[model samples]
Target: MSTERPRIVIAGGGLAGLSLSLALKQALGDAIEVAMCDPALKRDPHGDKRAYAIAASARRMLETLHIWDAVADKAQPIRDMVITDSRLQDPVRPTFLTFAGEVEEGEPFAHMVAGGDLTAALVESCRNAGVALMPTSVETFSAHPGGIDVVTNGGGITLRACLLVAADGARSRLREQAGISWISWPYRQSAIVATILHARDHEGRAVEHFLPAGPFAILPLKPETLPDGRIQHRSSIVWTERSEEVPHLLDAHTEDLLDELERRFGLQLGELSFETKPQAFPLSFGVARRFTAERLALLGDAAHVIHPIAGQGLNLGLHDAAALAEIVVEALRLGRDPGSADVLDDYERARRADITAMGLMTDGLNRLFSNDALPVRLVRDLGLGLVDRMPGLKKFFIREAAGLAGGTAPRLLRGEAL
Candidate 1:
């Protein structure tokens, strides 16, 4: 057996980068070396209050990587989801559609995981797997015929790798340096994210209330243990608002904002109190002109980003990592260069359709429901109602949401070894 191993370096150690590192390690074993760079990750190894929706398929990938077990105790399964369309002050926001999030007897289609917990688990897993975790950003890099040389801090520290994966984010400096043009447009909206302690149990139910402003999501989260060993019900709230209104909402008094949240959140979950100061994220849609360039490949937000209406942004990025890892591993087995044009082309071809379809779906849904036009409202509500009444169609959607319907699915998603 050859002792030489190809080196793969991932920039921006967020979910996508961490995932790719872990997947590559699993698939290639000692055949390849993986490294990740992102100072922000090391700065706050403990994540924030935001929560992520990991679909069933993504969960399986986590399981295969031996990550699910580390964080499963902190994960909250989403048993059911209900959708409604109404105004902020509407006396009633009747549910127009609902989904049963189960793929089998006891398996839910998705889970709500605290970003901090997930990140901590992934970081620990990466360390145990012997993957190099660099606490610095990729300042610049040059791609040559055989490999790419990356400089961490203005030529201070340099490293060469056969492949350079850009998981930097939507505004990726690596992508820009690679001359990869991406189409990006702001959505004129923003999301306020925060965690709340509620007075009652959520029963593992999630809710999305669509108002003229945007979608207000109440995502169930696992209970928290206090210093006194008391359990408190908690959930993540994603409140979307027009960009112009975000400043006022962010600066508003806590009491005033709580009142607004209550109006939309309903009294079902009982009293709500913010567990942390709310943070705002501007909305936008972006897709790179190409997924690969020379010795480089884009993963996660570096390649694409979409509205939060569907809560699939992270899930899509994880899928990218899975597919890319599979392709790279197969190429290695065949004695082919992992960063070759052919390998990257195959990865791009496999992922383009899925990415484009999701972008369009989320964009359309945001446009359809973020308005008060009576005709548009009526038509969409009717559509939701119709879908709700159709068990077959609902099942298809459930499967899709579970990440079960798609091409280019990796072995990990199929519950198999890499």
Candidate 2:
């Protein structure tokens, strides 16, 4: 290996940013310098509550950072998934077109994780792995031919690396500072997320019901991971709706919200009640005009943000991190600048096909399901049914959805029993 190590500067302390910090340190050991900046730390969010379903692929990434063990108790592995296209009148009988395979041997594709727990785990991992975490947000950033200069309220820190990663999230100020334009489309809807206590066991299975308005994802909460290290049962729900309808729904009381949820959710699990008041986030699809510019590179939401219908938001970003870290590690070994133009091009090439395909698929799904177009619904339901029947094809869907379809797969994601 080359005797030289690049200094890495990461913006945003969220999943993607914090993750890069640890992954770099783990791979480089004491060779490279890694620094990350974020607003407040952890889940000290002054914003609304949100969560994501961590695919088995993503869990492996966290394991690589040593965060999975810390937060695994909070995750409920989705042994199976039941998908349906339900109607208001025929709510009891949701057409079960496609279901995931559970007895395939190894494990399910993904698991359920709360937003708070995930952030906390990442923060702890970053600290444990010795990745310097700057408890400051970026004031701005400027990329030059060699590296970039980043300014934060705490002070100015300049990192000269092979590249600068903008994992700062969808509204990434870093991308804008670098003059990267984004392609955006309004989704005309909002997702309402909250915790729920179901009368029956989820059996570690997730349910997605495609309604006229949008898709409803009910993820099972395996157990709670307490600050004191105790575990308990819990689960979270994500309900999507029209923009204008969210306010009215949020304005509803707990009972009303539960009633509304039950109407759309049906009696799959039975007697579901809200454990937390619903929170709403406007949904949209956005992708940067370019994944890289000069010495600057983008990952995660900063690179692209799509409808959450598939719940790959974080998984996509984490995979981007994994891909990038691998590329940089290999480049440095060859005595190449990690941020060099050629190196950056290779990173984009490895990820672009998969990223663009997923974005388009999600965006198309969202648009196709948002309305009650008879023809569209008919076609979609038929498609789901076909997949259900095609066991060979279902396995492919599971593996792809689970993020297990990469040849240069990251270490943790290989499910190597981390």
Candidate 3:
């Protein structure tokens, strides 16, 4: 290893990559160096229109890194959540399960945050923490005994680091180059995401309607105030539909789109109008055969991509960031190489089971609800109803969803320093 302070290079600057950089710098201070590269960092921070349900543990990690305060005002806490199963044409959709979102005295299980806002906050935090935010993409890298040599796409800037992390997202070129096998299968569904301006407040309530195609999620967002002094009650919609029908829906007339949205949205929020153009994302489930190899480690979508049925994808990535940061920080503080096979193996071991469980859970949920089979519906509905009646089980599920159930949670996730 280099005689100077060990450096870690992250090959993406998305949520996971940025968070990992911030976490390492915050914990290790001047003892270690962190650099992150992603072309998206050079683009407008507000370009992303998606919103995410950040679980309680992820919020704690952000708080520990001093990032939560920057975005807190814009985050809408999920005070409650309701789940229903019904067909699109059904006049009545009965709620099969309901949850009061708090997992602790006053801490809600999750908060809905706009992707752009959170990303901007994280970027700022990384800058303030002294992380080298390179506005370039990693073109290639080669791991040797001492460290990994990373070459950037722009100007062939070569960076030598103690470790190279691939956070470049689901279609990671680095993962492919490293010969990491990816097991994946596409879903028959795609999610239509958009912002909805409703006439009434959401009251921090989130609703998930499981239709024949897939689950339609209405997640609350902080109300927006216009310059005209009007407060616009807003919510984000994740409308999952069959993949074959996405193009027609996207190209549909405004009136036609509104009509289609209303069919699933109902009239509970009074009037509804588009706050932004709807966008569709094809859904898929995938996991890397291995999370680590040589001095290279995968994070976020580079490691796995799960169904969005539970809104846990981003949170899972955050978990990866926290866990990896903790492991690397601890190893470095002990005078061990942070990128060594032993250190990387510790990270992989710490994260694999959690990732596997979440993948299977989301996949099973999507499969069980995204169909109209009578037998399956009856069994699943009965299960939901039974769980709803059991307060203990309900609380357990809420804690698990909040990422607070496991005792082995990383220090950062528990709102602690390394």
Candidate 4:
């Protein structure tokens, strides 16, 4: 073998790709050369329209990479999550289910973060780790048994390494180019998202209110400011709506949009108004049939995209980055080819079951709530109530929410940085 350290060329600069690079840097030290490719599209992250619920394990991973402290002040810990049927005749019915507990293993359930802030933090950490990030986009790639060669708009470079990763996301072109297939279907919904200045302080709580149309998620975020110079107490919104209504909703006036949003949100938040433009993303579930192929691997949205109802999408991907990094580092330490089929297979075996389970869980929840069939509704409602009544059972959920109840977790998310 050539005595050179293998080079890893990751396609996608989003959470997964950059994070993998950061994790790899921590895990392997100077034993690997890492390159991340993305368009680096210009956007004011401050004005971002997306937010994520970060599990406790995910937070520890950030800490290990030394990126958590950079954006620590921006995140709001989710002390509790209250889930309930929003259509009770009195509208004040007992929660169908409630999830609350520690942020870590013994910690709160999760942390709310603006997607842009998290991305910015990851990008900054990548720089600090000496991971070369290419601002240009990757237009194509070719994966071979020994290495993967990528052609980017910036130029063509042969990544002669043990592995290549597809962290590009649900529409992962690299996955396609590498001949990986996915079991995918549109959710037939669009999640309307925005930062809202709530009438009341969130008090570090989150809610997954099951409205008639879909789940309405209200997640807390650190206080922020609008462009007009007004301080705002912001909470993120994930209001799922029928696919057909999305465009009309987007075109609707601010007052009209808030009117629809307020009804589902109820009086709990008092009057609500948009602190930013409402953003809508088409929702879907995509699971790759395979995660490893020859010298290629997939992580984050590239591997699977579950329902946001569980708020586990990013957490799952972060774990993927962590696992793949560990596998590669171990392979290198053993003087084995990082891209060897055996090494890649181990990565696949470690991640497949969890990824598949999450996909099914999210899909099941969406199906359960999307319909109004009396029997199904009764059963699920009763199920939630039962869980709420059983504190012990509820704690199991709390652990799962924190991303600590699973297979061996990566060191970073364990509250120890990489």
Task: Mark the regions of model 4 whose C-alpha exceeds 4 Å error after superposition.
Answer: 41-49, 88-94, 103-106, 225-231, 416-418
Cα displacement (Å) at residue 302, model 4: 1.5
lDDT, residue 245, model 1: 90
Models sorted by lDDT, best on top: 3, 1, 4, 2
Backbone clash pairs for candidate 1 read none
Q: Best by TM-score, which number? A: 3
Candidate 3, residue 363: Cα displacement in angstroms equals 0.4
The local distance difference test score of each candidate is 0.89, 0.77, 0.94, 0.79
**TM-scores, in order shown?**
0.97, 0.91, 0.99, 0.93
Candidate 4: tens digits of C-alpha lDDT, residues 255-279: 8877878777777867788877887
Minimum summed lDDT over a 10-residue window in model 2 is located at 42-51
The better-scoring model by lDDT among 1 and 4 is 1
Ten residues in sequence with the least summed lDDT for candidate 3: 1-10
- Model 3: colliding residue pairs: none
For model 2 the TM-score comes to 0.91
lDDT of 3 by residue, 1-418 (tens): 5579889999998898999999999888999889999988889877788999999999999999898998999999999999999889988999999999899989999999999999899898899999998999999999999899999999999999989999999999999999999999999899999999999989999999999999999999999899999989999999999999999998999999999999999899989999899999999999999999989999999999999999999999999999999999889878899999999999999999999999999999999898799898999999999999999999999999999996689998898977
Report the C-alpha lDDT of model 2 over 1-418, residue by residue, as the tens digit.
Answer: 2355567778787777777777888887777888787766633632334657888777777776678887777567887888877655663655665556342476767877667777776777677777777777767666677566666767665544556788888998878988989999888889988888766677787788787778888787775456998644456777888899998988888788778888876675667776677788899999887898777789899999989999888888888888888888888767888878898898888778878889999998888777687887788878888888998888888887888764667655664321
| Candidate 3: Cα lDDT at 275 | 88
The RMSD (Cα, Å) of candidate 4 is 2.3
Give the per-residue lDDT digits (tens) of candidate 1, residues 1-418: 2346789899988887898899888777787889898887656767566799999999998999989998899999999999999988789889999999798779899999988888888888888888999888899988888888988863368888889999999999999999999998999999999998899999999999999999999999999788999889999999998999988877999999898789878999889999989999999999998999999999999999999999999999998988998999888999888888999999999789999999999998999899899999999999999999999999998888888875648787877777
* Candidate 4: residue 298 Cα off by (Å): 1.0
Report the error of model 1 at residue 138, Å.
1.1
